[model samples]
Target: MIVAHWPPISATLCPKFSGHVNKPLKGLRSFTFNSSFSFKASFRCYCIKNENPNKISSEEGFSVLGSDIPWDSGSIWSTMAFYFFSLHIPFSFGGLSVVAQILHQPVIDPQTEALSILTLQTLELIGALLLLNYTAKPGYRFSVFRDVIINLGMSKRPQDRHAVGWSSPTAVNNPILKEILLSSNVSEIACILVYCIVTPLLEETVYRGFLLTSLASTMKWQQAVIITSAIFSAAHFSGENSLQLFIIGCVLGCSYCWTGSLSSSIVIHSLYNALTLTITLLS
Candidate 1:
């Protein structure tokens, strides 16, 4: 009886493997292995990135057209959490409100209102973008849009485009928000910045853009929409405002899911806020 010993397969043997790997399935890398014995055999090995057979597509949230939101569900959650604590600690009312009270400027805060509230919105947006850029994959940073103008322009119809990701998985809206400071000394400019510009951009980006879009990649998109819209509503937090905000959130969420971009929602949000503020001021 002859017991033949075989050397461990090395990388060099891969070249001689006769199996042909066709264009691999999405999220799959194919490897070929060969064995020489009584009969030659070729084996194909596939390393799958999205291994789940039940993973849903983003576009399927409303239709089969597909999702434009990039990043996996895991990345979505991690980034959302990171974005929240990083911004919330510095910018939210609870945060700066404490500093204002301590500084004895609670009643007359001209400088703080201007510096920390009015101007700070721009800084916060810049910081959020920078953070997103840092965490995004190699080629795509804020690659969520078909066109950059779409975030600020008119709505575009949904298409058959899909998102690419390092792995597969799924936001509700952000909880951090901007609001009109009730202090008598708070500037109208600060209110404008918070409502017209800051609130719409920050909230919409967090809620409709990232949160809602991320959830679009799931099987239960309707639930995701309702949940995210509810979160957006809760951030405003008032017995009177809750129902109104919830309705608005539903509209924004549906607009995003249908139009496949943030522009329409942002426009609507900005307009509604501006109108409400204007009416409040006039009255």
Candidate 2:
């Protein structure tokens, strides 16, 4: 207590203590501020670089095969009209000619009927291919068709014979059809090929692939399927069997819509025709 250098303890000591306490807090504040700024900058960069994962790409929206027809284009109607006339007019004329030729014959044999069926089916198949190639770019692929067939096989149900009118004796009693079924020669083989393969392929490609797709461009899918089915049934010109044909057509249309492949409907139709032919042969 000798008053040894009691030189202003309040000023010097208080200033030194306050400086020591303030230094670490200032460094901590600077570090926190720099870290926050850097975090904000990186966050902005990440936001700028990333895309929304939920967005649908254009390719995905329009990648449905057989649906590549330019529905919105003005030329679509003209193209449809061309397809209709080119396909049906030639087929109708050729079919009538064949019927006329057959009727004119002194004898309408099974071989003759088979030949006529083969000719008609061949013409139809050719016309279908032409129309498909002309109207739709990147036309139906075999892979797509195969997928459709597989799907049809997986989804098929056993149909009721009576309900579908197949139980009616008259259904399989057509003289021409009976002759083809009864024959065991090459004519019968040809008949089977036409009914089970060529006919189904042509009809399904036209009605389901081309017509249904065209109709769907303007109408609801349900309406398109119904209208196309109705037209398909009407094209057969079946009398009392028209109702059965209509039901079959509806089934085919639904199959096409479900699978988005003409081949599916074709396979179902072929199997149905094959079953009918088999039953007729047995009976």
Single out the weakest 10-residue window by summed lDDT for candidate 1: 163-172
Could you estimate the TM-score for every candidate? 0.58, 0.59
Write model 2 residue lDDT over 124-184, tens digit each, in one string. Answer: 5665565455544344445434433443221111111221111222266454466655765
RMSD (Å) of each candidate, 1 decimal:
21.0, 16.9
Best by lDDT: 2
lDDT of 1 by residue, 142-254 (tens): 56333332464221111000111100000011111122223333555666666676667766777766677678676466777898888766554345556777888898888
Name the 10 consecutive residues with the lowest summed lDDT in model 2.
155-164
Can you give the lDDT of residue 228 in candidate 1?
A: 87
Scored against the true structure, residue 1 in model 2 reaches a CA lDDT of 14
**Clash list (residue pairs), candidate 1:** 59-66, 59-67, 73-170
Q: Where does candidate 2 stray beyond 4 Å?
A: 1-104, 137-170
The total number of steric clashes, by the backbone 3 Å criterion, in model 1 comes to: 3
